[model samples]
Target chain A: MSATVHIADVVKHYGKVEAVKGASFDLAEGEMVALIGHNGAGKTTLMKMMLGLIRPSRGTIAVLGENPAAGEFSARRRLGYLPENVAFDAALTGRETQAFYSRLKREPVKDALALLDVVGLGHAVKRRVDTYSKGMRQRLGLAQALIGRPRVLLLDEPTTGLDPELRQTFYDVIQKLAAEGTTVLLSSHALTELEERAGRVIIMNRGLKVADGTLDELRRIARLPTRIRIKVADLPPSGSPAWLPTATPYRRINGHIVEIDAAPDEKLDLLRRATADGSAVQDLELIPPSLDELYAHFLRQAERPQ
Target chain B: MNALITIAAKEIQQAIRNRWVLAATLLLAGLALSLTFLGSAPTGTVGARALDVVIVSLSSLTIFLIPLIALLISHDAIVGDMERGTMLLLLSYPVARWQVLLGKFLGHLAVLAFATCLGYGAAAVALLITGSSFDGEGFAAFAAMIGSSVLLGAVFVAIGYLVSAVVRDRGTAAGLCIGLWLMLVLIYDMALLGLLVLDQGRNISGGVLSALLLLNPADAYRLFNLTGFANVSLFSGMAGLAASSTLSVQALLTALVLWTLVPLACATLAFSRREL
Candidate 1:
């Protein structure tokens, strides 16, 4: 896939503290990538460098095939960004704020105003922003970022104050945009929320890119144990089960529930063995490593010395 | 160019919504009208043209009042945006940083100009309607007074932008701006007064004194209005200085224009280097 954003060895230093330390990554065209990390892990700084709001101390970043730090607006007009703490003049009505951004973007004001309905802010468009709640303001921020049908979107903590229903609506819009070939970068701390939506995730810890891959790939790299559970209609009353595998150990979670721990390679064999006897096992459950687990594992691995 | 106008238009809209325009206009009109009537009272007893005498009084008032008003309106224009996080949003758009600074400066200058015209215009019209007779030269002096008053406001607005660009917070910008007003209008001349008294018209000759007066924008504005015209100068009690002063009207006008440009250029330069 062709890359839309190519970041090479970018580092940003503030006084003695380095916010981003030789970080490197690429975003493919029409890809939705999630940047997950804790607070102060350099997520916002990285996004700012991409937006050309701040210059990096070393290396380079390119957006839409143009150098972002060159202070040129030719590429920026096609890029959209929603800062973490979005702020607007409180006296301006929602519609007025939208109008101003549309003018800045040099697009038709009507087209920008139409985005208000898409973000579910059509009802409160006439009210001043100071009267809107945090969620409403977030939606307005989203509407502003959607101006001019931008080709690339950089959203920081996009779903911070959104309700679950609005969050779903928000992702639906993102999915539609991605379907139209808009490259999206979501920088957030919401791991679970992005696990299903984002095809690729980049986990950061203390300004270092600890892991960058799909969930399944990271889980495989982590090498954590997989869990398998079987519910039996009848519990074997004997001290040991004759049907149980000899090599793998089994523990009893309850009278009818038997749990088995399997390594990554041994997972298929354990599953085949448990399903071989249909009369013994009533229900089976297999739990793979979750993203939260993978995140913790990667953070730990990143801290270890070479 | 379009971006510049759009940003400036937003500032104008903000001023209207904030009631800054109305307040400025009302304040200037009240002060100018009071000065026109109350100041002209001495003219009836002294046998001088009422409007020309009012021009002399209002020129001195502009020296003290316009700079403070300009600073009060513009001191927070840049720093407040950075503090509020709006500057980031504005910069994210496809516009240059200098455009933002220039747009805000133009919008604020327009606001000040509007207030100066309407506020002092009401007094000028009231003087004419009250049957106060004045010739073409007297009216010309009144017009110059209004025009130079706006220029003085522009100078302070530009300085306020410099303070706003350099300071990190609105509180500090406001503090420095107030201190600037004090120094230029009150303290600078007070110190100059002591210097002139000590000089005894010997070491600091009239040429040196005129150049020193040009250092402060208020003094430049005073020389342009109060001393440029004969009738205004006689009534303004600056006849001695006007006769001996070598600084011409054109030079004082150029000084006011430079006062506006130098600070505005500094503000643009300072804001461009800023991280935000």
Candidate 2:
């Protein structure tokens, strides 16, 4: 598969401050990728550069195999975008906003109505945008981007301020689009939200791409330690000798419970040996390295000295 | 072409539905009607010529109402969107920046032209109902009045968009647009009068006057509409005093074109760089 988005040593600067410091990455066609980073980490800048809204200070960026700054309408025709803060003309009703965008994109008028239905704005179509709540307006924005059958969708914090149900609806729509061979590149400050939805993640910090891979791949790269909590009905004395030699850094939470971080391979063996002693074991809970922890680890590395 | 029409249609819908725009347009129309009636005072045959008086009132009133409407219509073209965060949505479509600018310009011009025609037409109908004699010259003058007002309105709309593009906030854009209008439409005329008074009999002929007229879009508009009428010599003499010859029609047209170009170009450049 061809790379839909290719950024080669892209450097973007705002005068004295560098928003992106020679960042480079690529996304293959039909992939759902997430860009997670802290505020001012150049995620917005990079996304804008891809959409031809901003020019890079240095380096090359190819979105759908074209230099974005050319402002080529052909390239834009193939892409759809939902900005972080989606706003509409207050005077226009939801139907009107959708219709205007559809007309501008040269799409079928019915597409606008269909998108409104999909985004759950069909009932509110006649209401002016000024009366729309934040979530309603966002849905309208999504409806517009869905017009013209675009091939690539660039969404910036697509679910900001959305309730949990609506957010899930957004993810379902994204998944449906991606399954239909549409490439999606989404950026959001909400890591957990993206973690559950994105097929792959790109972690950025200080305008640099620190990690980019599947969840398993990133977890291995970041080496974020695993956490497991064990609860025992009766406390084991120091002389009980139930613990394995590998559980060296294990700490007792209380008289009965203990918490420890161990390698994935060693975790089961450690647990088996601990329970083998049968010193009144109660229950155990294992927490793997989630995308949130991986994100924090990369962000911290980008901030600290290696 | 469809893109342009699409944008224009949206702009018209937006302007019509906006309470503030509707209010401003109505207010200007009301003022236009009031000014028309103000010129109905009974005077000598020359002054009592209601058509001439109406023409003068219109010429003067448009100096204020044209800019007021222009400012109201266009001072929010880009800045308002940026502030409200709607600009990004507009930009995300496959529409080009130039299309947005041109479509907005045409939309505003259409609305203003319609409003002006309504006001001017109402005044004309009122004059006819009042038994005012309709002379050929008076009719021609009235047409020129409407034409010049539309041109002047278009020029100021471009200026307002330019100011809106450069300023980030709506309030600042409004203030700056209004300030520039006052300086050009109000203060520039006064300043020209002061200059003429100071340089009386100094061979400040029409060339200088024409050059100054070219420099000020407001003055260019005044000269264009008010020339060949009752006080033609007052303006032509001013042109003569400031320069060797009277202002050329060609030169005036060029100046007006430049008036539309400079502000529009600035607006385009500013908008292209803006972080919408």
Candidate 3:
């Protein structure tokens, strides 16, 4: 599939400070990509470049096959953006705010108003935004972003104020949008949340694209250690357990809990040996490297000299 | 065109919802009515038309009050939105930056115009209903005063937007806005008076004097309303200068229009380049 958003060697500098180093990535159509990073890691800057809010100091960024920052307002119709700290006019009601954006986008108000209900804001559509709670305002922000059924969505920390249930609904809406061939680029601090939702992960560190691939692909490159937990009746003799391989490294937690670190390739081998007969291993769990570990591992690798 | 109108409508709605429209209308109407009734008391003794006296009083009032009200409503139009993070989301849509700026100017201008018309128009109506003799020239001068008053407010609103565009924070914008109002409405003439006293009309000719007054929008507005009509200029005590002044009525009106457009254009340029 063709890329819905493309960035090539794009560098953004705010005076002497380089906010986005030369970064390159292509977000495919209908693919949900997660941009995982810490604060000031250039996630917001890169998204701004794609949205045409800022131009790159070097290289180029293309959204929908056009330069977004070149002052062509019509090109942004297919684009949707939700800022990290989105705010609406406080004096206007929710419906009024939605109507205003709809008019600006040249879209019909009926469908945009319908989005208020989809985001579960039907009951308070007429209430002033100053009276709405943070989460409700977030829902209104989401509703505004969803205008025009935009084919490209760039969301920055969209789920910040959402509760667990609202987060579920948020992802559900994202899933539906993606199913309809929308390209979604989401930046958030919630690693586990994106772990289950994003089709691929792009890790940025210190204004650089550290790693970009599927979760498993990143794990294979990082070679980070997987975890293995085994529940046993005894403390596994403090150091060596007869049921486990002697060369493998492990530690005992308590009288019943023991934790083992296994290499990526050796995880299966270690699990098989521990659960050979279920005689010593009452309960067994083989945990692969999570996104959190892989994320930290790639961040550390990027910080190191080549 | 639709986007521009929609933005203007939204601003008008915000003005209504915030009670700014009501306060401005009532304030202008109350003051205009009081000026009409009280300023007309001297008409019988001074041999001036009652409506003509009202026009002069209202024009003087417009020079002081409209700019302050205009600045109060518009000093934060762009910078406040940018600081609060709404400009980011607003620009993410399919609207150009120029459209946002122009839309806001038009909206604020409409609010000012509406208040000016309804608020001051009530005074003209009251004069007609009080069983007074009326002529076409008197009513025409009253209408011109209202028109020029709205134009004066537009000038300050544009100036306010310029402040909003260039400043980094709302506090700084507010400070600069008040300073601009003081300079244009209060201090420009005061400083001109000081210069005239110092020069004693030797260095400053009548042509230079008229050009100097044209520099300040309030002066331009005052010249337009006070001198555009014959009786009003006599009552305003500028009849001799109005007759000998090189600046024509069209020239002063053009100056006021430029005062509104020049700053608005500058603000749009500054806002177009501003980073959200």
Candidate 4:
């Protein structure tokens, strides 16, 4: 599949301060990419460049095969953006706001209004935006961004104000869109939330993309030890398990449970040995490096002098 | 073009929903009607036509009130949107930056035109209902006053847009707009008068005086409405200045239009280059 969005050597400078310093990435069609970073890590800046809200000081960005910053960029109709802390006109009703955005996107008003219900805002469609709660406004923002069924959707902190159920519904809608070949790039601080949703993750730190890969790929690169917890059936009151590998260290939680940090290559061997007879181990659980840990690991790797 | 209209329509819808249209219309109508009754009272003694007197009074009112009203509505158009984070989303659409600027300009101008026409039209209608007698010349002058008042409001709206585009926040835009209104409407003419007195006709000639008058949009609007018609100029006691002045009606109107276009262009340029 071709890249729906492309960036190469993108450098954005705000005076002497560089916001995005020489970053390069491409998002393929139907890819759900999470842009995870701390605040001021240039995630929003990169998204704005794709939206053509600001021109990069150097390098080029293409969205839908057109330069987004070009004056006559025709691909804008097929691009949707939800800004951080998304805002709408307080004086307008939710329906009016949706219709306004629909008109701008040259989409049918009926379809756009229907998205309000899809985002679970049907009950408050007629209420003024000022009266709506933060979550409702976020739903309205999401509905607005969904107009025109944009092929490329860029959302910054989209799930900030959403409840758990709404977040589930939000991910369901996004996953459906991605399934239909919509390229999704979202930036958020919620790593755990994105861990299960995003198909791939790009980690940024200090205006640089430090890591980009699937969870397993990043895990392979970082080589952080996997954690394994084993509940033994019959453990001596004072002695450790004889089957425990001597190369890897183990921590005792209590009489029956012990947690061990297994290197990636040794995890399967240890698990097999512990469950070899099916009599010594009552339960076993393996936990890999989470996105949060990977995020910190990558940031630290980027920060270290190499 | 469709995007332009969409943005403009949104602005108009917002103004209506916020009661800006109703409030501006009522304020202008209330003041225009009161001025019509009170200012025309002396017309009976002076033997001046009531409509001509009303035109003069309304022209002066426009010089002060219209700019303030225009600024009040427009000073926050760009900066407020940027601060609220709406402009960032709006610009993400297919619409060009100039389209947003011009679209909002047209929308605010429409709002001002509606208020000016209906508010001042009520006064004219009231005079007719009261059986005030006036010739075709008086009617023409009344129409010109209303037209120029809207034009004058457009000038300030464009100025406010320029301020909005250049300022960092709404508070600074508001402060700058008020300062501009005072400088143009009140302080500009006073300072000019002082300069003329100091010069005592030695350095300033008739040509120079005309240029000076055209420098301020309020003065240009005042000159166009008050002195464009002989009947209104005579009643307002500007006939001598009208005769001596080299500025023509077309020149004054052009000055007002240029006042609007230049700042609007500058605002568009400023806004297009502004980083959201």
Residue-pair clashes per candidate: 0, 12, 0, 0
The pairs that clash in candidate 3 are none
* Candidate whose TM-score is highest: 4
lDDT of 3 at A34: 96
Model 1 residue pairs with clashes: none
Across residues A5-75, which tens digit of lDDT does each residue of candidate 1 receive?
A: 99989889888999988789999878999998889999999998998888889988999888876867888
* DockQ class, candidate 2: medium
Per residue, candidate 2 scores C-alpha lDDT tens digits across B104-193 of 888888888877887787788888887888888778878878877888888889999999888869999988987898899889989988
Native-to-model Cα distance after best TM-score fit, residue A84 in candidate 3, in Å = 1.1
DockQ versus reference, model 1: 0.81
Q: Model 4 chain B — which ten-residue stretch has the worst lDDT?
A: B39-48
TM-score of model 4 relative to the true fold?
A: 0.98
List the lowest-lDDT window of 10 residues for candidate 1 chain A.
A236-245
Worst 10 residues of 2 chain B by lDDT: B233-242
Q: Tell me, per candidate, how large a share of the native contacts it keeps.
A: 0.85, 0.79, 0.85, 0.92
For residue B43, model 1's alpha carbon misses the true position, in angstroms, by 1.8
Candidate 4 is graded, for docking, as high
TM-scores for every predicted model: 0.96, 0.92, 0.97, 0.98
Answer with 1 or 4, whichever has the higher TM-score.
4
Of 3 and 4, the candidate ranking higher by TM-score? 4
> Deviation in angstroms for B67 in model 4?
0.3
Off by over 4 Å in 1: A236-254
Best by DockQ: 4
Instruction: For candidate 4, write residues B155-236 as lDDT tens digits.
Output: 9999999999999989999999999999999999999999999999999999999999999999999989878998889878
Per-residue alpha-carbon lDDT of model 4 for A1-306, expressed as tens digits?
999999999999999999999889999999999999899999999999998889999998999999988876479888888899999999999999999999998899999999999999999999999999988988898899899898999999999868898899889999999999999999998899999989999998989999999988999999999999999878877756888766667888877898998889988888888888568888888899999999999999998985
